[model samples]
Target chain A: MSSAAQGLRRTGSARRQPARPAWRERPKPATQAAKAVALAAVVLLVTVPFLIIVSTSFASNAEVVANGGWVLWPQHPTLNAYRELFDGGIVTHALWVSAGVTVIGTAASLACTIGLAYALSRRDVFGGKPILLLILFTFLFPPGMIPGFLLIKGLHLLNSYGSLVAPVLVNVFNLVVLRGFFQSVPEELYEAARLDGAGEWLILRRIVLPLSKAALAVVGLFYAVSYWNAWFYASIYLDSDHWPLQQVLRTYVVGGSQLADSAAGDASAVAAPQTIQMAVLVVATVPILLVYPFLQKYFTKGVLTGAVKS
Target chain B: MAIAERDATGRTGAAGASGADRRAGRKGRGTRLTRLRRDWVLLALMAPGVAYFLVFHYGALAGNVIAFKDYVPFDGLWASQWVGLDNFQKMFGDPDFWSAVLNTVWIALLQLVFFFPVPIALAMLLHSLTRDSVRKFVQSVAYLPHFLSWVIVVAVFQQVLGETGLLNNVLGDAHLHTVDVIGNPGAFKPLVIAEVIWKDCGWGTIIFLAALTQVDEQQYEAAAIDGAGPWRRFWHITLPSVRPIIVLLLIMRLGDILSVGFEQMLLQRASVGPDAAEVIDTFVYYKGLVGGDYGYAAAAGLFKGVVGAALVFAANKVAHRLGEQGVYR
Candidate 1:
């Protein structure tokens, strides 16, 4: 480094920086500037692409083309793209499909996982250890894709929505989390409840569920995000018409196929396919963004506890 | 639920508290039957999940028998002509399967070298920040992308880096040659690794960040008092503290090396062609699901599964030899 620049960085106003603990040394201004730049880059790198998609989705057709495909910010924001999407067309149907699957799938997954985790959390439940062993072994060597597909085919779940949720109803990781959280609850509490003649379900409902709200929310969010984002299974299992939003987005947007004009009746001045694609992207993404923030803090606890265990 | 305090008729009143203790001494079939009758409700609770694992996981697992059979759909999975090692021999000879294996390993290696340490570095940087609000805000923004579907992530990348994408548009305005990335086979690997990094690097920081947060402040303080600088403190305290986690995660990653983002590659496989994107999973998808070559595909998949399971066992053995807890007991 140049001596002058080094000297300036060393002598840069430390007053502007936050106070550090006595044991910690203040970083040089150059280091601070570099850190700020790195953080900003990290933040922007993640956020800018989403911004461009949203901006272009909302941008008018002329503005998008004028900017040569994508607009960073719209000159005149319009809801036409979303209007086309929600015009009771393929995308609208897909959105509903996705919402239904996420809701129903999350509920089903949470129920099964809770039951299994709670049952297994108790010390001497019949066949608890062996059942856990059976489940955990699947984690080590999961069923091969081909065999799994054949099983689905054999079961006649070829075009059924149950194909999506049934195979993946109870995620082992989420089960581990709930099990760990359930196990952590005091034995004394279970003792107290059992003394009062509380049944296993009663204790689980009254004590375990209330205490495990954070873990449940996090697990529910994971399941919802997974179901929402899933398309590959839908691609293989269901027909295009029954695909969720993610699968349709994959086909039309990423696959570069055009949306059929007849689905969205009239007034279709034919916006750029890129705009429509971005609009679909936003629509597919908004649900996750809406639910994630509320359940964000619980992620650390839920993930770490489960992760640490296995 | 709380209102129902009815206990089972025959079992002890304080059943659960002494359940594990009593079971330790009792091994009789009579006790086992007693235990079964006693825990019927719990058994009922576990029925759905157990049935799922049994049917979907193990039952599908049993379907691997088709790997040794010809798997004629008309003759059915069971009555199909047995092929013994014929499918394996075909998979061994077929250059496409080998290429898919090669691609999977190549991608997995690329991820290990380029994508593994990202969250570690990001975690350390976030840990060093003094301002709580800045740290929290940056974290919120950073991990948000992890929630997006691969389809959306791929679209975002295409929108930004494709032929007529933003970068090209800027280059065209400046009269510079626009780079072709989306379709360039050579760029496919880097593009994939970049997407993985962009989508998951932040989320990956969670474990390492948790590790860092648990580091004792006194270690840094003591290091400073001993005249150790920032780099020295980081090397001595932070690195050593998270080393076990890093090593554990590395072992887990190495064990599952054949998996290289199947859906992500499948989404973009058509754009760049299978040569650039056919990992083992995709190969199986195409060969089995799409092309109807069930027996051959199942053989290839079973091969991958066995190798993966063996690697996990080998890695776990190594972990135990090194005195780490490993993935499981």
Candidate 2:
């Protein structure tokens, strides 16, 4: 009856239509070949730097420096950088901390976010409206940094790992996307669950979540990426010893530090500093590279549909 | 348009509220309360989320009180003496503060001018690709950088372009003079912008790509029938179809002018120095938390926050005036 409600109805229908344009037809074989070449060129441009980083990471220091600070393909590629990184040093400790934080943080964040989003998605759920408003209000007026830090401090979370996880447990954008997805599930499914004497939790676990896998994968990947990449909170809250890989990378690469402890090597080992730095870059970026392919299938449609409706 | 509908709904809800008010004094004055009492199980499930917001968000909001206080660690916030307007005065008079503001505006403007069109162009290019597999593969590669941390991105740039890095190494082999890009004060802004484009332009394509999907196939077919060339069809059909999304994103970007990537600048600040790298965010961090000048930093931060909010509000209002759908209803 309400226009906002009407718009919501229209949006759902619009999504279902898949509106193929009549004028647009499949391309000719020649055009398709041309398109493939252009696309490959774009992909090549994006991939080259990453390839350079990876290659240089494995390259010998002499080879790296001799080739004008590049090692397109290492003459004598070695696992020495990785060997040094994992051998009980600052980067080793940082690597462990980053892994722990990402795993623990992503799980906690995904759970809390899904719980809140699902509750809000249900129109019949009691206290949902006020709760939704409370959550949404935070989007409009985010807390200032000082207050956030102070609150973390007051909770005695400072210098602790919990500070990194607690402050950003639920991203509002992710919550909205997840909620939009849950809302799109057919109402008949919920009714059928109720008829079968299934409770909300059971329905959520068996029915809702199963159906929303694509969305969950996308949102989960988003959470994982953000958590892995995060350094600001860790920089402010944790001691330097407890710093994550990104923060460690920040100190070494951006701060331009050349002290070889173990990650790059001892000062006497003698390697190209740029190569060592590139090695660190690869180490930091590898997690994202690992998770991308699995989620790439759902990304475009999942992200676009979720974002546009909001 | 959405707001007009919302207003009508709210007006009707308001009318319904008076009827509920009249019934409230009768037999079921406490019915809603009774309903709430029955919903305790649901409340238990919702408690963590509610508590999370109460502490992290609202508690932090209450922490803004430190903006008026001296904020000594031992004394704590409640015990600190209020120093009204001193911080604001100091912030206004600081030359570094002014430079940070100017730098922020300049970078944001550059992003608006140069960086903004990248995603649109990228989406167009992707949209034009005839083969779906080729288009998707390109997209995956383009989106890769967005996943990297700022630390990694900066590191990548340094390795490729720093004085003794790959570019220099290669140039030396060819007997060419090295050109500095990374950490150079003159090149800092452009480098930062370039880094942003590399990392985010593809991600930005998400919205434009979505818009492109909405363009009617019939329109393109009609243009082809009219003997229009590919370029003419693109200009007539595709660009206009995606115009609204572009306008909407531009307005949103304008509102975020004060924030030109705090972490990225902070990481690079030592090399480029504050003169070139300082933005409002770094300025606030240095003034308040890092320098132990809480009140002044808060003032600077508060100023940025207010201005950002005002910009969003103004932009949204302008969008509404132009008969466009803004970010919110």
Candidate 3:
């Protein structure tokens, strides 16, 4: 046996083979403790704020005020904040806008990206090299803000929903990701499909896409998240009545604007501003939290493939 | 179509006068035609994306003409009077613009110094873990914040560190003095950098972790048998393995130094005022879009873009000099 294998076996005899290489002796206690501390710090740093946000959103107004604007954990959880949020006002409307934009934008972006990426992945496609360089050149030197804003204004998309989608229809990074995944599909499978007289669309649908579900899901999630979280375009292009949930969150929560005017006529005068703001933050964030785990499974594979191949 | 087809067939016919020429040229043109015809579906599929780039990117590029014009909204782009370098000259003379430039550079340098190495360090910590489940769970938790919008991230910070936030609450309960962090002009740069590190350090680790996984197992084993300890093995094996990626990411960071969080800064710009918060992008937004000084704003933006593009080229050249591929060929 090779010395490495023998060493591993010898280490195996002493205890378990180290989860990494046999070279790692069991980590010294200090190393173990340090790692544990680092892990705990990371987890707590990420989770504590979420915990506070959710808890404060569910806390009673009196409790929130008494606790100085945040609740680590609610004494009595309540949905009153959420009810007030959806009481047919700006937050509810913005939530619908966010959902609609995310759904439509993700679908359109994924379809366009997949179609373009599939086309570009083919070796015999006409003008592919120049087209790719053109796309990539934009990545290097993006069109500046004033010009972009002017283009949107010129196209009469300033107040339209198309302002958000049109300006960022297909991200080149996502395109490259999908293209890398498509190129990784075996040439033999493509040749086989072509030999069967399958058209490009059919090949993409029946062959390429099926093999690319992980990549598509990851890229789709990216599009969905960006569209969902987008506030800047909405802030600039649309009026207050057409803002998305993120923009609403930005205005009320981060912008520190009192919602008293927005909630002026609402029946739920009992809900505190902190509660409502936290509720809005949670509502804006929850959809991504829900979708993240599934797509996260593919993130490493998808991103690495895209990064390495590109 | 008719003219092209007739030309093609006529050429084939002319080539047909010579047997060998006819076979080669006719076959070549026929296959080329066939290939062209076969690729129509792909071309059609590419149309939306191609059109999107043309209209949004190239069309926007064309709109950069306003930088040279004394633009009036009533007169529109074409009717505006051309003023040559007047807008640029104005920008060069504006102290606010220079302050914004300085702030941008300051924030970017702080991020480079403080935030850049965090992921590499975190990746090392995660890579040393002996348990799979712990590592996976930590990775998932850490990467979660990366997907949160900057608004949410900033709000999270406010909830944790603002005057009436968790930190103050704890301090109040303990009868201690409270620290003002959120909206404090003096603390704005560090606060923004801290937020960036919190949001991205985990996501950044993804690439380094991937690099770590690629470090050869044999190297570690060989080093261990040779009496090297963990730190030595890590220094000799792990760091060297990920050096190329680290350099690549560093170059990319250098190229992007001018853009130090537009949305994040915009969201907080009002809180800290322009003195502490203004950057090139926000300056452009406020000047051009909000203030209606379109020509001047466009000029400032064009300057930033030109310098940024130049930086990218220079950084790429430096990378090539160091025997790295950098971003492109």
What is the TM-score of each predicted model, taking all chains together? 0.92, 0.88, 0.92
Candidate 2 residue lDDT tens string, A176-262: 888777766666566677678777777789999999887798888889889899999998999987899999888887787763655
Identify the runs in model 2 with alpha carbons over 4 angstroms from their true place: A1-41, A262-273, A308-310, B1-30
lDDT of 3 by residue, A1-310 (tens): 1221222122232443435554568767887788788889999999998999999999999999888898889998998889888878888888899999999999999989988999987654777889998999898888899899888888888888888888889998889877766766755566677677777789899998998887888889999999998999999899988899999899888989867645522855688889999999999999989998876776665243334423
Candidates 1 onward: DockQ, in order = 0.37, 0.34, 0.40
> What DockQ does candidate 3 score?
0.40
Point out the worst 10-residue segment of candidate 2 chain B by lDDT. Answer: B20-29
What's the residue-level lDDT of B62 in candidate 3? 87
- Tens-place lDDT per residue, model 1, A1-310, is 1221122122222422445778788789998999899999999998888889999999988888888899999998998888888888888888889999999999999989999999998777789889999999998888998899889999999999999888898998888877766766666677678778888889899998998887788888999999999998899899987899999988888998877686543345667777888999999999989987865666554243334545
The lDDT values for all models are: 0.83, 0.76, 0.82
lDDT of 1 by residue, B62-99 (tens): 99999999998999888999989999999999999999
For candidate 3, list the clashing residue pairs, or say none: none
Candidate with the greatest DockQ versus the true structure: 3
lDDT: worst 10-residue window of model 3 chain B: B1-10
Off by over 4 Å in 3: A1-21, A261-265, A302-310, B1-34
Q: Any residue pairs clashing in model 1, and if so which?
A: none
Candidate 1 residues lying further than 4 Å off, grouped into runs, are A1-19, A264-267, A302-306, B1-30
lDDT of 3: 0.82
Clash number for model 1?
0
